[model samples]
Target: MEKRLSHVDDNNTPAMVNVSTKQTTLRTAKARSIIAVNDEILALIENGDIQSKKGPVFHTAIIAGTMGAKKAGDLIPLCHPIGMESCDISIEVIESKIVIYCTCSVTAKTGIEMEALTGASVAALTIYDMCKALSHNIVIEETRLISKTGGKKDYYHE
Candidate 1:
């Protein structure tokens, strides 16, 4: 069968996909966000996290990312509300960029890709918000799904 956008109706109006009949299964997804920082921002990093006037940048981002993942359904109109079984956020500095990875898992009818993506994006934003005082030049380069498994198909990129 030809694939169509799940979030659209016959009239081409936006709609939420109905997952009611779909069988429940374990679903998981991972997403990545990369933020480029200048040397001034990098200098603030110590002991696995950056300390700003607000708090530990990496630690706060982790918490915020998990919350974002849980709230994805409320934030995105088409997304189905999912009670996530687990959410993990990891942050690392490589070269001049801050790399964030968000992994989410759930037992549900739909995949957990959106939650992971939202988590990573929010984590990157939290980092920017915390470090903005030091430099506005901080760049959030990209947020993309790294992998997803469940439902009809599985996907992975590098």
Candidate 2:
């Protein structure tokens, strides 16, 4: 097995990977986040009663997710700054939980998995922020990369 270390030095100092020699490819990644909310909040969403003092919940989250994907490198240390070609965010309410999916693509030397993950996570946080007044029992259950393609190796969730 090969160890994928971020740093080439034994000290493991923080540094960005040099991808100048790597081939540029069309890379895409999809990630998802599940946020579990209380029944009261779910009821509000189902009833379409999102007229809180904070404004619409789902719409705002979608916008925030897109912005977050573009700024992923600024938020995450050691992540290569990437200019995403496109970012799409979608949210679906399932029973008492909300599912957020963010897909990002770029033609570059690096993959966009971090951008996708960041987008979903920020969107989940935005949802929590918007709905916290209704209930504080919200839980960001999980955030994971669903798939990645066009890199040296392709990855998919099993």
The C-alpha stretches of model 2 lying farther than 4 A from their native spots are 8-11, 46-49
Q: 12-79, model 1: which lDDT tens digit per residue?
A: 99999888899899999999999999999999889999988899999999999999999999999999
Candidate 2 weakest lDDT stretch, 10 residues: 43-52
Which prediction has the highest TM-score against the true structure? 1
Q: How would you encode candidate 2's per-residue C-alpha lDDT over 1-158 as one tens digit per residue? A: 67778545556676788888999999999999999998888877644435567878888899999999999999988789988999999999887789999999999999999999999999999999999988899999999999999988999999
Clash pairs for candidate 2: none
Model 1 clash tally?
0
RMSD of 1: 0.8
